[model samples]
Target: MQTVVTAERLWDGTSLHQHPLILIEDGKIDSIATHDSAPIPARAQVHDFPGATLGPAFFDVHIHGAAGHDFMEATPQALDTIGTFLASHGTSAYLATTVTASLDATLRALDGLANEMAKLPQPGRARPLGIHLEGPFLSHEKRGVQPAEHLLAPSIATFDRLLEAAHGHVRLMTLAPELPGAVELAAHATSRGVRVSVGHSNATAAETRAAIAAGAVSATHTFNAMRPLDHREPGILGTVLTTDTLFSELICDGIHTEPEIVRLWWRAKGSERAILVTDAMAAAGMPDGEYQLGGFPVQVKDGRATARGVLAGSVLTLDRALANFVRFTGATIDQGLRLLSTNPAAMTGLAHRAGTLAPGKSANLVAIDAAGNLVGSIVGGIQAS
Candidate 1:
């Protein structure tokens, strides 16, 4: 059976088409055209949104979990709950992010998550693309809520062990650039096809530059968990903002970053290098209360998630992040959409799997209003319920 989706306008990650009509067959996009360019097929099922802008569904490369379930659970039930919640909020795929924990526990979770990633994506659910290792190699001075005891020095041998446990499914890793051997680890991780992102550090400008030179492609959560920028010494935060080649992740929830700083980050990274991520935890989509981020207990109140007086992840969804970013930056909706979809996908090297609407691609997309609010989401040609 064929499905036809029509909207007032469409931004296919690269270009906008007015009166856009998309045809899907067997869950893949068959063709895209304007209403004036082609007639709708008589036998196809049609879904129309009169005043919505259709675009590629979001891809969250730095999410932990949602719907009161942590990705560290690494269970089928946990993934199903998280994925279903994510899809409803316009996310089509995400990286299963892991926080620092015991070496044995981390390996066990990785093994389980890799097995889950191997399964076919469920209809109307966001799928896990790969693993994002956000811990074990971090600066204790800037670890935030990441448990201190579990933090490890950068080590190729340890990374290799984790990668093997993940069955080579580790696509991204966050490391503190100031740690000894971190530059070498960055190079080695890049050699193994893993993208390195510098964060959780108090590194000086020169150390941050060394990491970038050694293949650190991005920065994690820009301002948070990073050395503050200074006029004389600068630091990792300064290098991240000034480096045009490096991608930077920002959690746009008003709690994680002030609006003024969000605006600053937007001006610095612009549309090309700026990426929006939820950095969401299990408390996302759930009522405020106590929640778990990895093995640590976090207190949630009024949209803030904290552990030991430090911000721990967030409860913001990508859709909300989109709206907040647009409100803060005054950027066009197309630019905001690209920050959540195109930039993150490109930064994580998963552009082929997501970030665009094209022929032979999965029929994953979302409908948003002029204000960048999510109106509806579709995954695998099925409308999210």
Candidate 2:
């Protein structure tokens, strides 16, 4: 089937153009032309969005769950619930992120995530592109909400086991670079095609750089759980900020990072290296109350999610993240896609298929209001209300 969509504005991942025409066929974008130059067939199905801006769909590479369901539940229903919520928020795909837990429990979650990836994404749902392993090897000093008992030393054997359990669906992993054997483990994981990220660590600048040299390409939730930036020592946070090659994830919910700091981060990383992640747990989209994150209980009050006095996660949605990012950085909507769509897709090896609104790419896009609110979405060329 062929479909032609006309929008007031269109962002093709990098730049926004006025009055554009998009043609999708067989689940892929066939062509994108300006309104005046576009050839619209008489028999083609057409959908016009008058006041909405059409852009490449959002892609969250680091997310746990939403709508009262946690990905650790390891059930199709849990994924379905999360997927439905994400699609409605303009995300066409996401990584099913896991928290620190016992080996058995983590493996179980990995198995479930792999199984979910093997199946086709339901209509009007966000596709589960892969899994992000965010635990099992972290610094006790900066573990944040993750339980201390399950933290492990970096080991190739353990990583291999977890990788097997995920059935090669593990796209990214977060570990503390200061741990013993971390450099070797990072190299090993990178060799096998898994992107390694440094996070939840207390490593000094040198140690963090060593991990980056070992193929650690990113930092998770920069400046949140890791060592603080110091003038003399300049810990992991400093290394992350100054390193031009490393991508940094920022949770733009205002609670995890102050708006001023977010502005600074955006300035340093620019549009290319800065990535926005919610790090949101099951509390997202639900009212203020108690929620479960990775089998652990958490409290949500006044928009803050906490566990045992430590900040746990958030209740933020991608649409709001986009809005907050635009407001904080004074960036245009098209430039913001570098964080919300382009960087994540490129990091996870999905850039060839998804992430952009261009010919030969998946017809995954979003409809947003003038203020950057997601009003509708399209997944694999199928529109969602």
Candidate 3:
């Protein structure tokens, strides 16, 4: 079946390319046409958004939980609940990120997620791109919400086991490059098609560069946890800025990184390289109070969440992150849209089908009102929850 969706404007993420209608066929873009030039064909449905702009469905590289559901729980039903909630907000896909916890709990969660990923059907709300392992190997001093006791150096055997158990569903791993065997572990993970991101570390500039040279392509939540950028010897941040290919993640929730710094990173890295991620937790779509991240107790207050008084995760939604980027950076909607959508997909190697609205690309798109509210979301040519 063919469908035509028309909007007041269109943003492919890379740029704002407004046309009268977008033609979707067989769950992929068939053509982008001007409504005035082409007559609507029979047997085709037309969806019109008179005053809204159509944009690529957002792709969140990092997110833990939302809407009274969390990924760390690792239940199929729980993930589906989260997926339904995310789709309503224009998220088409995301990595179910895990925080540091007991080895047993981590393993159980990983094992469960591996199974759930395999059982999921094709049609749904936002889908899981893969599992993102954010802990078990980190710097205790900067563990954030990760349990200190669970923080340890990488063990190839254990890491390999977990990855194998996931059966290639684990897409990214976060680690501190200064730890023993960290560089080697990152290299191996990258070799297996999983990206390595530097984070939760106090690694020096040299150490960070070494990790990047070893295939670490990103910094987890740039300007947080990891060493701050210094003038003489820029630390992890310096390494991110210096390496042209280095893509860094950002939490645009105003609290995590100030709007000014967010704008700076956007300017430096360009929208294509700075991926907007919701370092979100269970409290994201819930009210302020106690929640859980990877089985650890978390408390949210004043829109921020913490574990044991340390900044734990976040209570932010991806749509809100996009608004923050616009409000803080004063960037046009086009740039912010790319940072939250196409760019993140590119980093994860899923841009081929999921990112922009182009001929032959999967029809993952969202409609936004002038006020930045999410009006509607679509995934694979279907209306998402």
Candidate 4:
């Protein structure tokens, strides 16, 4: 059976073209055709979405947890709660990120997710791409809300143990390049199909470059706890901007980084080079108050959550981040894909499996109005409507 989905406008997200009719079969897109640009073949099931827009489903590679579920508490029920929360906001796939904790606690969470991953054939809740391990290898100077007592050196031996325990379900790992054995650990993790990101650091430019050279493909929460920009030394920001190979993630909550700085970053890196991530926590979509990230107590004041007054995480959603991007940057719809869909997917190596509404891509997508409101959503061809 085949399905031809027609929309008033379809931003392919992969390219600069906005097509009309998108043909899909099974779970993958078969082809995309312009509204008045192609002849409709017979027997093609037509689904019309008039006065709507279509783009690739949003991907959150830097999310910690949501809906009262933290990834460090990777239980089946918790993941399901988080997944359902994400789907309502137009994210089809995500990396369930864990926080820094005790070795026993971290391994226990990983072990829990491993069992759940094996049982997620139907995934009736939300979709999980892979696990994002945020710490266990981080810098104490810029640990933010991560449990510093649990932080450790990035050792290949310990990494292998964790990876095996994870059952190869780990997809993303964040490490401070300045940490001992960090470069070696990045290379090892990359070789095992884990996307490496440099974050929670105080690394210099040279150190950041070394990490990238060793296979850190992305930077987590750029311009956060890491090194600041220096005219003489240029620090991590200089290295990240200069290195075309490294993709970066931004928190975009109006608190993590200033809106003016957001615009500056957009101009410096461009949408295709920088990605927007929520960096959200359990308090997201919930009331502003005390919450937790990696077992550390966080207080949410004025929509910004912090641990001991240090910025812990955010209560921002992907939709809110998108809205913030436009409010801050004045970016047009053409520049939307890279931040919302394309860049994150490409950086995580999930581009082929998700992101973009092109032939053979998953049917995951969202339709937002001029107000940036997600009015319609589709996950694996199933409409959430």
Instruction: Judging by TM-score against the true structure, name the best candidate.
Output: 1
Off by over 4 Å in 2: 39-45
For candidate 2, the C-alpha RMSD (Å) to the true structure equals: 1.5
- Clashing pairs in model 3? none
Question: Model 4 clash pairs?
Answer: none
lDDT per residue (tens digit) for residues 51-170 in model 4:
667788788998888887788888888887887788778888888788988888888988888887777433224577788899889999988878777889889998887888788899
Higher TM-score: candidate 1 or 4? 1
TM-score ranking, best first: 1, 2, 3, 4
Candidate that would win on lDDT: 1
| 1-385 per-residue lDDT for model 1 (tens digits) | 8989998999999998899999999888999999999899999999898888999999999999889999999999999999999999999999999999999999999999999999998878999988999999999999998999999999999999999999999999999999999999999999999999999999999999999999999999999999988999999999999999999999999998999999999999998999999999999999989989897899999989999888999999999999998888888888899998999899989999999999999999998888889988989988884
Error of 4 at 90 (Å): 0.8
Worst lDDT 10-window in candidate 1 = 376-385
State the lDDT of candidate 2 residue by residue for 46-80, as single tens digits: 88888878888988988989999999997989988
Candidate 1 residue pairs in clash (backbone atoms < 3 Å): none
Which has the higher TM-score value, candidate number 1 or candidate number 2?
1
Each model's Cα RMSD: 0.9, 1.5, 2.0, 2.6
Question: Native-vs-model 1 lDDT?
Answer: 0.94
Cα displacement (angstroms), candidate 1, residue 337, comes to: 0.8
